[model samples]
Target chain A: MNLDLRIPMGLLFTLVGLILTLYGAGTNGSPIYASSLGINANLYWGLVLLVFGGSMYILGRRGQRRMEREPQKPADTDSGAARRGH
Target chain B: MIHTELTYVDWIIMLLYFVFVLGIGFALKRFMKTSKDFFQAGRALPAWICGLAFISANLGAQEVIGMGASGAKYGLETAHFYGIGAIPAMIFVGIFMMPFYYGSKARSVPEFLRLRFDEKTRALNACSFAVMTVFSSGISMYAMARLIQALHVFDHLFLVMGWPLGWIFTFSIVLSAIIVLLYIFLGGLTSAIYNEVLQFFLIIAGFLPLVLIGLKSVGGWQGMKTAVASIDPRMLHEWKGIMHPATNPMGIDIIGLAMGLGFVLGSGYWCTDFLVIQTAMASHNMDAARKVPLIAALPKMIFPFLVILPGLLAISIATPHTTTTVSMQGGAIIHETNIVPPEVEQGRGLVPAKVNPVTGKPMLDASGKPLLDYDMATPNMLLHFFPTGILGLGLTALLASFMSGMAGNVTAFNTVFTYDLYQSYIHKNASDKHYLAVGRWATVGGILLSICTAYAAINFNNIMDTLQLVFSFVNAPLFATFLLGMFWKRTTGDGAFIGLISGTLAAVLHHGLSLPLEAHPGIHGGWIHVLHTYPSDMAQNFYTAIWAFSANLIITILVSLMGKPKPEAELVGLVHSLTPKPDTGHATWWRRPEALAVLLVVLLVVLNIFFF
Candidate 1:
């Protein structure tokens, strides 16, 4: 539960985004983008993904830092009240 | 259709996705120590995570492809699947039913039934649900593998490796099944939930671009509307022709749509089905659990755009033209043609007719017109617009969807089988550690069974349709039993069990007697006798649900009145009237489940009117 899901999500997107951005740059004017109507969709969408992924990574790191700085609270007080076993 | 190509960059992108998914499973491995952890994520997930997983678990390949197919066939009317069919039931469950589920602290939906009803009812539900989930997962596997083969996604790679072209189906199926099996086995429900959230975002990433580029190609919404209007102006509006069964593309009137889909089948699936509810049940507390469905409802409603718009785009865009090039591969002449959907007629647009595999001819309907294979709408759109790099991403998204969907069913199956069937019936008083091991084995067994079913599906295509029909029959009357049991504390186990059996029988009987027009006298109904002929299959399905639900409700009420009810003391948390209201804890008024439900309802109404 301590592991922030966004950290992994952010890493995956950032890596894919980087790859896409570089590929788009290398193939900018190539005919490979013709199906995408001559627009470097990979470049633009990759940048968009990069920004989103970067923010998620930053936010996740911040959340993790905050959790570490604060004393770890019990996961939930109400969990004890809820039934546990079948 | 010409096979789309993938470059090294595309391969890298796809490989990165696989690495990340498996990495998360490994990262979460140590945490999954207990049976609770394995089956229910230790009941520790936060609302947003659970919320996304809640929707994503249901957002399998069938949803992505099926909705797109429906969008092409029914146009904006397809929004009814969310607007009227799904959203209300989701809101209803969150607001009215979550307390009973989360409050009673049942491990699975069947367990919940056992607490509120009896052992017999639980056994009936658990067995049916177990069978249903495995088959559904298998169906997803089959669909994904076939789609890969149809798209020729790995054909070039297979050829390069000196593998037969037919092996792609087996390779894709086995590979995806193993991937799903490994993750779930490693991290249990937590991995599935985490991967589902990732898959949710990836689906958006993949399809959102398709919609944008497609709209831009066709000059945005206005241009797309104009293009669709030329096909059928009614297709542009969601409710224009919905007053009569024969008029609308869906061939269902408001009553059938509201009662059958919205009230019966929708609630039955969203509220009672363990696959989705299990995600909500994994939340940390009652408040978070309540918020899960409400949170999911927002994205769930908006998904029409992400999924269905591509279908509209597929049909609206200019007809695809194929250019063939002949080349020599291993001294054999290879004719490569660009595989895009072509318009057979003016209104048909890019939708292609269903072709007979053996005869290599278009399949004709009872009306003599060719049957349109609307399932191609989304795949063709992905292939048409995306270049190699993004195409790989798009296909990965599709594969991710299939895997997550399979994982959802597998997790749900393992839980039900472990807790309800194995622990309760097969062997009682087993150690917690013993059950955890059983759960892991169940996960493996479920995937293997799913693989067998997937292969079975490949050989017998009607098996999917037949299983779906059987599930609907078993599922349609379910909400009524739950509704009475939760609200009316007087309902007894005998009443529920008999009511459920009778309801399923009613559904079978109804389906057998009623026939959809332009269909044969078998799976399409009317096997017993053609007493009523529906205008469309959708109408037939809705009415079947309505009949089954009505019969169950009436019979359940009648039967319950004749039986002795459980004592009030025993029914406290299990009954709606007896249980106290759930506290919102530190949540703001705006963030409360009821408030969110209200907001979702308003949004649903606005969407209906906007599209109307």
Candidate 2:
């Protein structure tokens, strides 16, 4: 169970999410969106990414914490082992 | 058609995106302790990430632009690609097919064939797939280079640096290819998947704004509808002229779409194509694997809203609808036909439109029309809408999409080359480390091969057409072989192998025989005049697939029944009836693949009805 992806994925998403959210918020009332059917897509989508990233980050953090609480058990993964053909 | 300025902020944003993607790739390089990690992401990706990458692999820059071009040429009718062509096949793959693929624990699609039938079948699929992947990947490279050239992205930079314009296309291709080769060489499939997911987000971020700005410029969806309807009423109809295959602008009818595209070509791609399925295989478990393609369905069904609509909107904006009269040799005069005047074509509309002397605007005809280049619709729309900062993001999104597609193909190519061809034949029983080394070298070799293929691919007319030709030539018949072999225990190894070869031959024969004599616009198939003449390349591609598939199914059944059937005991996880889902007990209704498939089908139906 190498579920070690969440942390890095979470960090990347959060970083991009933050930038987009701020950019969206700053451009909220800009006339640039006049051509976009008056929809602040950047704002809504940015917020959405932010929430998604935040949730992933929290879950990853909690999982890491839970794993830390357990005794330092060796990983049970067959990570480098060659796979057998079907 | 449109020109937008790029600012420092946009440049910074673009630069950041590139650095971040490359950074992720390099960082993941340390995790590649095994060949499995390089080839299959250590089989540990989540369903959601896998799902995004699965769809994003196909959603390349070529597809993005091609969809828009289709929209401009064919109108709402283009939705059939997503509606009839993709959704059903996706559901079928997720529900019925993934069980065998995931449960059998096949490392590749060819491995599945080897398990179910034998090595000969696997070899056939592996060889064709390896070749096709390289060719297709190269096409993407060529297309991206061509697009950047068309947009004049490098002209200004080259001018400032005293570089010749002729080197722009080659320079762009080589640079992008090197960057891709580096990351993929480092991280392999994991890097490709990660980059694809990032690209999925980047694509949405880039295009959503374009759509909003575009619709607003045209006064929303209603305005687009009115504008397109005013231009050509047929463009508004999903199935208007489909009843008359020969007469319609888009050759084939609904029946053609359902059987040719949906059943044969679509199933072949979604279920069996290794490039698409590699992401799904990287999932942690059976349940996640099943969810991958199913989840991809939702986005596939709706992408036309962005990809296709932009093309239609761009055409409307171009508005080359000036009515012209033409007299025939027999003295019959055609009236009010929307066509470009010969003089205007000679003066304008090749690269850029001629401008009015007084107004300095693009010159309009007596009927207030300007020359329209339908394929440039999406790019023009991007230029029309986005300002400096966002424009870079949008263009980068397109670039990201192309890169993602290229990465997917390269990864698939190397895996197939090393695992199926090289390891099995040339160096049997090689160490895992040795295979890993071969895969890395293959990545470099594949990129170089793809560059050659891309240059070769330019002899063809359109990227989309070339892709369809490949599908027709290889995958259509392959789907039939998979369909029979997976479910029927009676299917023989000899039957599968022979059937595959014959099916490919049938597709080639069909294409070389049935095409029209004249050089037709929108026709990019390898058809010669012999049997039947389709009105468009779409029809030709579909019919060729249909013919090939029919031949494959018929011959496979005939050959299979001739041999003694394999016993049920030997076909546990390979056969549908023998393979039971022991792990599915804990899965709730929503989590079940079949349930998810039904929900997706229902949504697809609703979308089709709404559009129709």
- Which candidate wins on DockQ? 1
For candidate 1, what is the DockQ-based docking class? acceptable
Model 1 off-target regions past 4 Å?
A70-86, B1-4, B324-347, B366-368
Instruction: Point out the worst 10-residue segment of candidate 2 chain A by lDDT.
Output: A75-84
Residue B515 alpha-carbon offset, candidate 1, angstroms? 0.3
When only chain A is evaluated, what TM-score does every model earn? 0.82, 0.67
lDDT (CA) for every model shown? 0.88, 0.76
Candidate 2 CAPRI level = incorrect
What clash count goes with each model?
3, 4
Residue B400 miss distance in model 2 (angstroms):
0.4
Inter-residue clash pairs, candidate 1? B1-B339, B2-B337, B2-B339
Residue B490, candidate 2: Cα error in Å is 0.3
Q: Per-residue lDDT for A3-74 in model 2, tens only?
A: 344565566556656665677677676544443444665566567667876787788888778866774343
